[model samples]
Target: MTAETDLIKLYSQRILALAADMPLAERLEAPMASVKKRAPLCGSTVTVDLDVEDGRISRFGQDVKACALGQASAALMGQNILGRTQAEVEAARDALKAMLKDGGPPPGAPFAGYDVLEPARDYKNRHASIMLALEATSQAMAEAQQADCA
Candidate 1:
């Protein structure tokens, strides 16, 4: 098989496992902030709700409706977001975008698992789907912070 085929296989297998075992897959009953994002390129959507305490994520929940890649991305975010701050999530989001669009380095630890989707860099059509989770999480965090200040 060609290199592209190999990459595709790896991406598929990893995504399948992540999606099947997605963490924090349920929606919260009363989140401090809730936000939904859609990736127009793939019609992938992810809705995230979270509670913050002392500027850190205290709880998180999400409703995901997307392709395997989107699901995997959300799963990773769910797994590591329990103690993250808005700035951290935004940094990871920006780093992930740069990695996919400009060949920047993958995100650092905590969010480093995103590197698994590196093969997606070659498939521009998948970028939006991959970004859904990060975007939604960022929005939710920001909103929750604002609410706290109010």
Candidate 2:
């Protein structure tokens, strides 16, 4: 397909809708862990705050300032974040990375929402932005896990 067609597919209606519907899209007060990631090429950014209990996220929040692709990714993560264990969140992030970088299948159920982003694989410049949400979530989960151990 042509670049225009690919672009159209990348920014489909579903992606736009998801971009606007991120849950818990705010910053938590006194969060146990927080992470912010920026896409150097586009300057898109996403911040995540988390509280984990018993290895699962008990609370989650975020501020996403990015292009539609990034927002859609954040929305997918936000929609499924609560109660996810750190391992689960990290696995989702890894799966997303593989999908984008290695042309692998979309993340599994729950994170299956990420399937819509498959068209993004051809746009390397957008990869980091697309990854920011899950990247921050995984990092925040790690920090929360460490804090819990302390």
Candidate 3:
């Protein structure tokens, strides 16, 4: 196989592997906040639900349908953000955006174990698919925090 083909295969395999262990569905208690995002160009959609308590996320669940990249991104987000605080989540979001836009390493531990997403920085069009879940979850968390403050 050509070098380009090999890279694609490797990336696809990594995404699939990340998604392989995710539960088909997740359950959440009430007082949960929800947000949805769509990449119209790719027909990718992700809806995230989160429950926050004492400023930390107590639960996270999502309904997602899209390409492998989207699904993998959702799975990764779900797995990593379960017990994080809103601040931590926001920081990670910022770090990810910085990494994508300015091309640098992530800022902190919130992104610690998920460095595989770094490859996505160069993936261009695939970036939207990869970020769908993160965007949804971040919006949901922000709304949830707002409602809590009100």
TM-scores, all candidates, are: 0.93, 0.96, 0.82
lDDT of each: 0.89, 0.91, 0.73
lDDT (tens digit, per residue) of candidate 2 on 1-150: 888888899999999999988799989999999999999999999999999988889999999999999999999988888989877888899999999999998889778779999999989999999999988988898888888898
Measured by TM-score, the strongest candidate is: 2
Candidate 1 per-residue lDDT over residues 1-150, each given as its tens digit:
799786676577777899888899899998999999998877999999899999999999999998888888888888898999888999999999999999989889788787888878887888998899999999898899999999
Measured by lDDT, the strongest candidate is 2
lDDT of 1: 0.89
Q: What are the root-mean-square deviations of the candidates from the true structure over C-alphas?
A: 1.7, 0.9, 2.6
RMSD of 3: 2.6
The residue-by-residue lDDT of candidate 3 on 1-150, one tens digit each, is: 777985686477777787675542364557469887998778888877888888888878788877776777677667678678877777777776777767877546755645666666766777677778778878888889888889
> Which prediction has more favorable TM-score, 1 or 2?
2
- Between prediction 1 and prediction 3, the one with superior TM-score is 1
